[model samples]
Target chain A: MSESDIAAAFEDGPAFVPYLTAGDPTFESSIEYVEALERGGADVIELGLPFSEPIAEGPTIQQAIVRSLADGMTPVRFFEFVETLAVDVPLVCMTYYNLIYQYGEEEGPRPFVERAAAAGVDGLIVPDLPVEEAQPLRTACDALGVDLIFIVAPTTTDDRLDPLLEHSSGYVYVQARLGVTGARSDVSDHTSHSLDRLKGYDLPAAVGFGISTGEQAGEIVAGGADGIIVGSALVDIVADGYENDLSVEETADRLEAKANELTTGITEQGQPRSERL
Target chain B: MSETFGRYGGQYVPEALMPALEELTDAYQRYVLNNEDGFMDEFRQRLETFGGRPTPLQRAEQLSERYGTEVYLKREDLVHGGAHKLNNALGQVLLAKYMGKERIIAETGAGQHGTATAMAAAHLDMPCEIYMGRTDTNRQRPNVFRMRLNNAEVTPVDIGRGTLKEAISEALRDWAHTVETTHYVIGSVVGPHPFPQLVDAFQAVISAEIRDQLRERTGALPDSVVACAGGGSNAMGTFHHFVDEEPVDLYAIEAGGSSLEVDQARGVAPNSASLTTGTEGVLHGARTRVLQDGHGQIMESHSVSAGLDYAGVGPELAHLVETGRVTPDSVGDDTALAGFHRLSQTEGIIPALETSHAIGWLEEATPEQLGERVVLTVSGRGDKDLETVLEETAERDIPAAPQMNVFSNPTTGGDGNE
Candidate 1:
């Protein structure tokens, strides 16, 4: 797979991007969960390779990380988890910068990106890696035919935005709000303004952060996002399964149902009601 | 103007914090570097009147007699809040006022920085809140009360071992949400670009005073300077003015909790000696020396002193150590306890447990290791550490401790009449 695969995932309609930590609860159960999302019509799947310190995540994802780490998840294990997946959608590994920078022998992101490319991973999203320090990683990804995605927040200025878009590939993560990653009840008013700011850029913008429900996803796509990204809310589902000791099949079915609901929400707003009729 | 120190120190935070960092960089250059609106003058005046600037540099006769070398102490313990923390806290809070920020927020491990920030915020009449780890709050209970007494809300972070690293992450999350109205006063000489430089600028007053006071008394710079390195604020403060002096040796003492051998299987480092044994990795917001496993996972670090329990050191300190301008050393928990007892007994000054790490290194060093004239920073007073000292002193057989058995059984004390 290449960066084009990720860009092409959004060509049909508004893409549904759902995230899950790779080894949360257990590694095998997580593989089932990712495949379930793909079956539910996910265009792109974000596989969170849990880092020890996930500063950008809120409580839900933080708890997911702790569970994944306790299950002995590491960089090598994450790649193996990626390779074990049977899904056909492009997989993007989302993690902090340290794991990518310190992956293999002889320092830097080259060795890690090389291994990730071989592991069937197509793109990367490092929340802690701002555009100022993203050059080396971007160069590595570009050389290996993988995309380096950047998150554009509501507070990102035009000077920062120019470089962010220049170095970005696949899609730009449009942070819907001003805070860390978590689920909120309502869609932020700032989401439209963020989409408006990115209207000039040619890259696809996937709105994330505080987006959970189908109504919220529909509202974001209606506000002009190319895709919708949800993490903490989905992780909340898995957390409920783990805490309540639900069967893997049961949890996987619930995830598939939720993903289908989100995708339906996205496609409903893909065109105007009068044209669809 | 540069954001990096060698290959270290850059903005590694999420993009949501980019504008705040850029704004802070501008403020730092204008108010701090250029003294825009006489900001430096106002900062210095407030430091003198409110935080008690120009702390004394006193020669320790007893320590000199014991070490067989002239020993001098930069008395940061004499500052109004009983530590070097107030210097940076006061500067950042006043800068926030200049930047028109309505609130103040900070994170602390030992509560010295939290108490100091709360006091500074109260003095400047700004609303303040602090994030402290649950472990730190439980150990340093008095400082929590002190912060509340100064009208600062103390929020206990109950995640990830509840230490300085987690508190910092939690505070960053808060700052990301409220950047338009809040200024996060990072406690140490760590974090991204302008933070390490900005906090160092506020803290460099220690070395400035030591340079003048030592030269006035001894007619020369000290042969060596020593301070404890948690996140390396005080160490950098003591070494800033003397960095270019070719003859002055700087020692950054770290806490060796039990041993330096990292438990890679469990992802736990028994010690907090990041400058001594850490590999290069990005943590918090900068690339620095951090205690990380082979697969790039940050390990949980331990230290007897709550202040020195962080897994990562300041990026500039990492650069300085790599460039050979500073030497890093580790002092074990037992040795630091002995240092605590010795200072309290002989010098009649109770040093904070964080400062005791540096004092502990004094005992292990040879006369040649510590030059003829050695200067060390008493980073804070031990008033807040009395309970911790009482509990830990009972566990160890420290020679200098006077009969800790009396307090081990509280009923034996003469407080029955009361």
Candidate 2:
């Protein structure tokens, strides 16, 4: 899909991408969560491939990962679930490099990129695979017609930006904050500056890393971001409501309600959503 | 900066961290490597005034008698903080200060590195946080208290068997969010490019002094130089200098927890012997010998010494071992403890459990293998290990595991020396 296609998916505003951790609580719940996200008007679904060591995530997502792994989530198991669930939206596989490397079985007969592409994965984002060492995985991803997206942080230098943008596809992940991915009270102050710097690049951009509320989403869209990535806040809702002993349908209802609030906030023009909330 | 170790190191990190890593690499190059504007003087002065440089190479008369050779102990344990960990810690803290960073973060396994880092941060008046595996925090209690006393926040990580790798992941996560203000003081010669090389240069002081001290004692280099390898920092420090000297046999003793050999019948994971029997894989940013399952999932390593329990060996050690520059050896739990007791009884020196691996190897080495005048590095003191050693010795039955037949194996010792 082209950048314009992604832009078109988010009619009237920036794309609202909801990231769901696969196999949270149970494998079935993960599918249900994604379904609810789609109903709440998610333009793109970023499926988190839970890793044993997720160094790029904060406590909220880390706990989700721990829960996912406890449910016996492995690389092969993740692909099997993706194949079975078969979500209709643009599905992106997000995880650390080790999982892809392990699942790829570098020495084994088959690489994971092949298996993921065959299983209907649309894009790939290994947070730990730098542009310097992405050729092998990129080669395999290219052959399988899978888009390999790259992330550019606020701390990224001017010289390094071009290489990352050149290699990225299916919209680039522009980190608004300097830290790991988690919901913050407000978006980073440097978000506007980063977006302005990235404006020159032809690629469609989305802002992530600590983007919490609908107001924050609206601000990012106003700042020229093509999409808004929401992860921890949505994941945290499921985690917080988990102890209340909700059924699968009830869980999806609660999650969809929260997703709708975020979706509405992104489409509306105003200050960061936290202040409005 | 490229992440590779003579075909073993490469930067396999995320693009999000590329700018930070490159900036760090450039800072390291400008300040430490290039010694831009006399930066080395400040680093060296700190090592001298704060770290107590030129640690003694004490002659072990009783140990020499027992081993039937002249044995000299490179006393890194005598350095401030009671371990060689401070050498690397002090240098990194200096670099962080040079970078104008106010907050410092690090990951520790045995808490020695954490205490050393905390001490450096304290001296420099920087706020410090250390990520430690809960298991290690519980095992090495005194060091935990020491880090706290120095005002460093000691967070006990409770994930994935609660070990070093888990602590590292936590530190890495913390670093990702606060890349500009925070500096990570990685404790070993592992990880991405410049880190492995940077850490080794800081640690190479162990060998630099040994070269001078050994010549002063024996008028020539010893027949062999020995040190224990965990992430292989101290061993890398001790072995790196001797690699070019063909006749000086470089030996690295890794922890062999229950046994080095894998029990196919019993279906047990082999002890923490990475070079002995491990495949080449990427772990903790460096492509090195790692104890991984067939599918490349990192295996949990077992050792009596928590300091030597890592599944991955240092990349330089991996390359050196591959190129026949360093001979890899193993010392199991029971024997390492036995070596600990013997050192205390005979030499009046209570060696750290990690350091005892080298002492244990000496106990079994024939006169033919370990020639006259051997230098052993006591990487750290044993005060921190007394509780675990006493408890383990009290609770366990002593059934001695058979040592591997290393003498017959040409590949066991580096082929170039033997």
Candidate 3:
């Protein structure tokens, strides 16, 4: 599908993106959680691939990776889980470049992307891959009709931003701060400034990191973001409720409630059709 | 012991290193059972002629009288190059030669292990490289200079907290890339499999010597053995040989940092005392008990002793504690400093701050509890720690004390002066 087609899916309302670590708590929960995220209002779901040393995560997401690894999670297992889940949401496997470099050759990203597309995934977001290094995967993703989303941090210079915007498809991920992803009491003022600069570009822009509550979702949408990405906070909720005997239904319901809270506020306060046109 | 003692020690490492760890484990197991080829004899010959072994066991008579219990010091300080670290470094280097590797690499914090590795590599006439944290290089300039003097290249690691942990990561990354010609000689018993076991075996010579020496002197085994645990090679080595022997109390003391309560709450919060606070987790490709949160992030641990500052302990030590083979304890930085001063003032022996953990435990052993005898592993000499001692003493405003004139008054043979 083209960018316009994906944009059309969100024309009726503001898009919701839910982020969760793959194989978190357990692989089964991650699969069910994605479906639950979609059902509750997520137009796209960012599935995080856990890494042993994540240089870019705060304590909360780092803890999620640990919990996932402790439960026997690996990159291979994560891809296999994605293949089996068969969910309908646009599954974007989000990860650092190290995981891909470590395991992508043996289990090629093309095959993984094809299987994910067959299993209902639509894109991928590799945070650390710069435009120079993204060509090979971008070609593979283009061949497979899978979107390759790139991140633009608040620190990205104008020279870097233009090329990133030119190469990016699906939606641009706007990091809220210079630091790693985690819950923070306040978002950076630079995020709003970056969003304003990104408005000139004709791609959908979503704001992520440090956005947890409903009020923050409304604020980001009002500030001109096409969508809002909620990650560490929602993952923290699921992780906090994780138990040895947690059923799939209970986990789904819990995640759905979180998704509803984030999406409802964005939809209610987002730009109306008249204002955008 | 729960297959890994609650996720603390296991094979959570890269696939490339697995064969090496397996080979090491097999070699160690065989060496322990039957030294049919006189491995220990050759090892001892090297120790005496080069590395130095059978370092004197001196009775701390003054401290013994003052504390009302007999205290014997196993002077690892007397070893060549002034610390017990060489015992393991020499052994591991020899193993590397046996394995037919041409180059050696290692990581060091406070530069002790780097210096030791450089010494071993120099003796073996092998190429050596040591990765050290930039922060540690600045603080431990003397040892850093010592490493360079021994002709080892020192790569300063500047990433991720800039400590021993980060140095280990950089070294591992290097080892992964250059696995064919390089042997990564781990400094302590904290890395992936076969390391904890191998280092423990080499250092176990300390306890084995203590066992024989105590038998000859006391005509019976002492009630307990104590040593400091930094990655716990010395403590585990000393404790492991006696694990099967009943009635011998083995204790490993960890740096408690500021306080026990604060350290426990920090839990790998970048302070030492891995056994007391670290949970089952993986780091540096080894499944071991680590001070980490629910998510696999490494925690910050605190310690006054630079040598003891780490986020994890040895897997074997964790296993020993889990199986009730030994007891682990913590002593704060202040108590360790006090122990250092007490040993100096009472016995004229300046102990390493890392070894002061063992010295501090002496306070817990009452005269009745210690019974007639006790032996402690004085893991390293205090030469490298002179600046640290002076700095700490100055900060604490300790009274100016007179230096004992042992060399001038030769009649007393430097005995019972304190």
Candidate 4:
């Protein structure tokens, strides 16, 4: 996972950012899915370590997280798994802040930021940690070479836009709607305008929240979003596959196929970064 | 830092909620700064006309003799909806009406806030939905009926051991989906910023009246002001005006169902003594002291009063606790029940289970040399707890006071109805 790799994806069409809750059915299945996601043309992979209480998740992701947590997805467990995981796409860990803070709570274990960096995570997106209260965590990430991404809301005022994007590393996560994370039928009408507002910033602008399909992903990216995050749709494919008679390999193949289809919808021909900047 | 109280309180919510929170902050500021919309006036008017404000500050003569001190109860129990909860729900619903929000959503623990919110929404003709834990809904059957009677839809949350935290999480989830059309009337002085500050302002009227009432009656402030803390709206309200008075000590009584000590011997975790034994952690979008286990996972709390069975205290109280401005004490379950029974017998006032914690604090740790004056907010009525009380006291061979029997038929020694 490298900064250059993520920037390179943005230089092309909208970088197709995809997410998977680590250890949804099992840790092994999740690792295989990440590798398959990379093969299916994922730009940067957002690996969500499951948490017990996710304040901002919708029914789809909430169920996935519950399943993952039931399967015992701790920060240590996720990090231990990621330590051996190898994928081409830069992996960013996205989850609630509590699991991160509770990481290594026993004695004098290394803090989550450093531990995540050592485990080879490239960036972080903690939806619960606003920039105002994100000092110590930000400092830890900064010292450990982990990028701390910031969130942009549709309700963000003009005065708040620059302040939020200024310190954002890796990329700016643009919340597509005024609600929690779930797949929506269409991209929000305000999303293109949000992307246009982020145009001046040098960071890659990725739109997420309520994106469930390849077409919505395509629409946001075509509307000039630097990337598109397709989470629940892909996670659903895995969940739905594992439900019935599908073997683990069959589930992995179905996930890989769906990821490939969604990837096809969002990515575009490569262009020089200088043209946009 | 601006919205925060000292190092505690900050708006730590999801990105999707920032705009709604900002709007609420702006609206609250306008009411305070301009008051041109007559928002505060309408809220005050409703408090007076509907909820019965300036509730009696009765001198507890019999209880005064028992404790050897002059004790006065700020009778919030007499308020409509039978608790101090109506004061806040009314104010917030008025604000919602002012904001042109057609719907309101709230989360409740003991069901008092739910019933209060439902009552306010019913008055304002707004569609209200309240989230209550399934356990709480079952535990507080009267309030559940009260909410339905007010035409507010009640959603029973079954997640996370079925309690306040889960109910709040479910409410937050609902709010995220409906933030555009729904105004979330948070039940206490907690949650993300603008909420703690705003809810405290709405509830501050309790202390404001107590201050004036005490000053008029005693020619000085009471030596101490005491109130129970759940999410700490009532205690914060009771302590707000007295905070600056050096002579007025503020004591926030927390729920200590069993003991504050985590008993490894019996493998019993400490009670819900959040301020007494909690560590600073973030929950429900605010930084506060939380009763969490060693691994930082929030632990379940036990309390005789459902209102105080929370993992976290209000951040304002957390700040006050850190600064030594408010001393937080935890009262055990048996002691609180004793206070409930004693207050009922002595003063003919059956306090809400939550308010009994404050009385328990007074009895358990009253001064050897009694102070001149004590002001306590009887946060709610205990008619709701009648069955619980009768069942609890059934085992004890306690006799009714001879004086109370004067109303009974002398020959039968039974009900006056007969």
Candidate 5:
């Protein structure tokens, strides 16, 4: 899988994307959970490379990251986890910029991007890296035939949006709300407005942040998102199972069921409003 | 005009904060640099009347006799809030007002910056809140009370060792959620672009005053200037005006807590010497020297003083140390405790534990190393450190400590020191 694979996944229809920390409960359990997502009809799987400080995440994902790091997850182990997963869909490595900046002996993004390419990872999503300081990483990802995805907040102005569109590859992560990543009970009205802002850009727009349920995912897709990215919703399931002392098979079953419900909603919507019109 | 110090500083934050940083950058250019709408003028005037600017540069007669040199103290301990923290806190709160912000938030480790920011917000009539680690709240109880007295809400962070780093992460999280109507007053010269530059510009007043006062006292600048480095605010302020002087030297003393050795298995470094033993990495929105493990995870840092217990240093200070413009050194906890007592007993001026790190370095240096004339910033008063000093001094065999048994039975009836 590569950047083209991710772009192609969105071309067919509104894609269903799910996220999980690479080593949330443990390394072996995480691989099974990711494979379950693939079986549940995921188009792109985002594997969180847990960073020590995840400033962009809210309570749910932040707790998930802590659990992952406590399990002794590292950059080397994350790449090895990526290589071990059996999913055929595009895999995106999501983490903070420090892990990417301090990867190898030499400092910069190239060494990490190079390693990601070699490790069979398809894309990179750095939540803490703004578009203004993303040129080096953008160039590196482009050179290595990987995709660099940028998140677009509703507050992102034209000055920032222009550079973001120019630099972003694979897709643009359209933030569904104003705050950090978390599971919200209600869908934000800002999702449609955010997608409207990205109408001029040529990249696929995947709405994320606070989209927790099948109904919310369906509403975002029906409102014109090219895809829907869900994180905290799925991570909550894993955390609940871990706390309840559930077996790996039980947790993986819940993940697959949740992923199926989300993808079923997106598929039931048939097509995005923009694609239909 | 540039946001970076060499290749060190940049705005490495989430997209949600980009707009806020951009607005702050514009304000920083107009009000801070260009002084538009008399922003800098009002800032200076307020600092003078409210913060008590131009703190005395007193010649330490006893220290001069001990070191055989003309040792001077930049008396920032006399500042209104009892530390140099107000220089940046008041400046930022004023800047937030100029930017039309309605609320103020900040993070603190030792509670000094929290107290300063709280006072600034109250003086300016802006609603304020401060985030501090739960561990710090238990230790620095008096300063926490001072912040509450100023009417600022103190939010205790209960994650990841409950220290400065965790407090900063919590503050950043709040700023991301409230960036539209609130301003985050970062306590140190760390963080992303505009913050390091903004905090440094406000703190530069310390050096600016030091240079003028020293020139008024003598005819020339001192041969060397020394200040302790946690996030390197006071050190940067003390060294900012003298970086161009070819003859003057700069020293940044760090807290060498139990040892310099990093416990890789536990992911902890027993010291907070980022400028001396840290690797270049990104932390708290800027790329700087960070105490991290081989896997790029920021390690837990420790210090006797909460103010100096941080895992990362300011980018500008890291750049200066990298370029050989400033010398990096460290002193152990016991040595700093002795220095704390040495100053109190000899000069009748009790210094903060963080400031004592610099004074402790003096004992480790030779006469030639300090040169003929030396100046150091007394960053804060030791009132906030009385409890910490009492506890830490009791555990160690500090020659300078008077007598631990004097206060051993405070609750019950006890005899005098005699």
Candidate 6:
């Protein structure tokens, strides 16, 4: 489908997306886990390409990447693992710029974008690549019909938002706070303020980071977010499941149950809140 | 000697860096066994020319007189980088060059070791990279600029809490990925394997010099030798040579931050004490005694001195404490700052904030208990701490209550409340 079609789906209701690192613990487990997330409630599945240094992540996601790397996960192998999954949900490849710069070379993200899209990846999240330097990847992704999602932090100013909104296709990623991703005890007031400020933009603004519980997910949707990205908390749930000595299938089942419970509760609660006078 | 204090000093690094640590251990062992011709000559040549060794030993006369004891200071501050850290950096950089390593990578807190490593690497014409926390880089801009001036690439780690711990984590990750030609020159007597041992050996010159100097001046070793324990490198270095000597009493002073009461109340006490309160645990890939929680999660430590602000102590020090070879003591920030001021006033020498903990303990010791002579390791110079000292002094003008005299409070019924 086209970028406009994907953006139009969010107008109906808030999108429920799930993210999992490729090859966490083991490669096959990650594939199974992603498919499980899709089966559970995920609208768009984000598959993180683990790198040695993940500057944008908090401890939970960092630990996942570390475990995946320890299990001999690499970029080439991660892409190959994605290829074998035969995932039904629209897959978005989330990775840092360093891994792409090192592995992509002069031909840049074109080859990777083409290969990834062919393997069923619908979009991408390159957190470190600012809008100015994103033109090369944007052109390549546009040619391949792949949506390149852009992120804006709470600290991101108004002047920076206009330029970013121009190139943004699928949906604008609005970080919940100024800090890195984690399960914060308190929701950021700035998240709603930032979303309201970005309302004039053309794209759907999905709020992420620190959105853990069903209550929080429902609140974001109530506050006018098009989608809520629950990353670290879900990764923490998967990590906790692994610690229980659960088999890959058992771990996937437990994580999917958690995602389903959280998303279903959010949607149910969200409907009543929005229907109220 | 088995080259291990316990299970603590064995090689526990990634398989890639095992050979280098082993090679360093082997070369150092061989060098120690045979004082071959030109061994000391080459070492001294490098020391005089590169490291600027044989750092002077000063006597803190006025501070000693105030406490009614004789105190002599081993001046590690006189080295090239204004800190004792250069002693290990110079040795490691040379060894890396000797082993045909093309690049040097190190981690730093407060930027002392980073600047020192950058200096050594620059002098040797080897490419160097130092990882420092973004918070530290902002706090220690002078040292960060100094490292950059020396042509070392400074990578600010903005991850985790963005402190020394995070910097070390980043350095370790970088080293693991580029282990082929990069040498991770660890800053302290921490990490796995020969690092703690190797760094101690290089820094052992501190005590070896103290032994010779004491014998020449007094014709005998002092009753007790004291030094501060950060990673326990300087303390271990000064104490290792005298461990077997029955007459010498060894002491490793730890940073108590504000007070033991404050730390204990806040549930942050253990992290403050590197040797005294730390327990057996693992951190930064090393099995050692660390100030951690029940689940082995490293706790936060607070100290006026950034250098001593770590949760873990060196493994060798742990073994030493276990064997009763050394006694551990904790000194509060007030006493340490007083010690810093006293040393500056009396000896015309400045001590690192880490070393002031040792000096603070000395200030509190009884004259008779201190005996005629006491030698303490003045681990690093206080130039880098000028800003910190001035800032702290401005914040608190009152002199610290006498540590010993506070115990004689009449209202508390001699229960030590001041």
Q: What is the C-alpha RMSD of each candidate to the true structure, in Å?
A: 2.8, 7.0, 16.3, 4.8, 2.2, 18.4
Put down candidate 2 lDDT per residue, A1-277, tens digits, no spaces: 4443343454445678889888897888888888898888788889898866677788888889888877877778888778777456778899766667666535521388888888888888878777887887788876777888898887788898888888887788988887788999878777888888877776667788887787778777777777889999888877876768778888898778877877787777533322322
| Model 3 chain B weakest 10-residue run by lDDT | B409-418
For every model shown, the clashing-pair count is: 0, 15, 15, 2, 0, 0
DockQ of each: 0.86, 0.52, 0.03, 0.47, 0.76, 0.02
**A31 Cα displacement, candidate 6 (Å):** 15
lDDT of each: 0.92, 0.81, 0.73, 0.81, 0.91, 0.75
TM-score of chain A of each: 0.96, 0.91, 0.89, 0.92, 0.96, 0.92
Classify candidate 4 by CAPRI docking class.
Answer: acceptable
In TM-score terms, candidate 6 sits at: 0.61
Residue-by-residue lDDT tens digits, candidate 3, A63-151: 78777876777656776787777666667888654445334334234655665566556778875455644676787778888788888
Model 4: per-residue lDDT, tens digit, A110-190?
A: 388878888888889988887777777787876787888888988777887876876678888988887777777876787
Candidate with maximal DockQ: 1
User: What tens-digit string does per-residue lDDT give for candidate 4 at B21-83?
Assistant: 888888888884468588888888889999999888889998788788888999999999899
Docking class of 3: incorrect
The parts of candidate 6 lying over 4 Å away from their true place are A1-60, A63-277, B1-3, B30-40, B261-271, B400-418
Query: Is 1 or 6 the stronger prediction by TM-score?
Result: 1
* Two-way TM-score contest, 2 vs 3, winner: 2
Q: Stretches of candidate 5 above 4 Å error?
A: A1-3, A272-274, B410-418
lDDT of 3 by residue, B1-418 (tens): 1224443555544333444555666656655435535666667788888977877777889767866767788888778877788988888787777667889999998678889899999998999999998888877889989999999999997665568877886777676435666788888887766677678778888888888887888878877778898788778767766888878878888988885443333324635877887766556655566666443446666787878888878887887887777788888776787788778777778888898778877876567646667778888766777667655654453333333334464432233333
In terms of DockQ, which candidate is stronger, 4 or 5?
5
State the lDDT of candidate 1 residue by residue for A39-157, as single tens digits: 98899999999998888989899999999999989999999999999999999999999999998886799999999999999999999999989989988998999988999988898
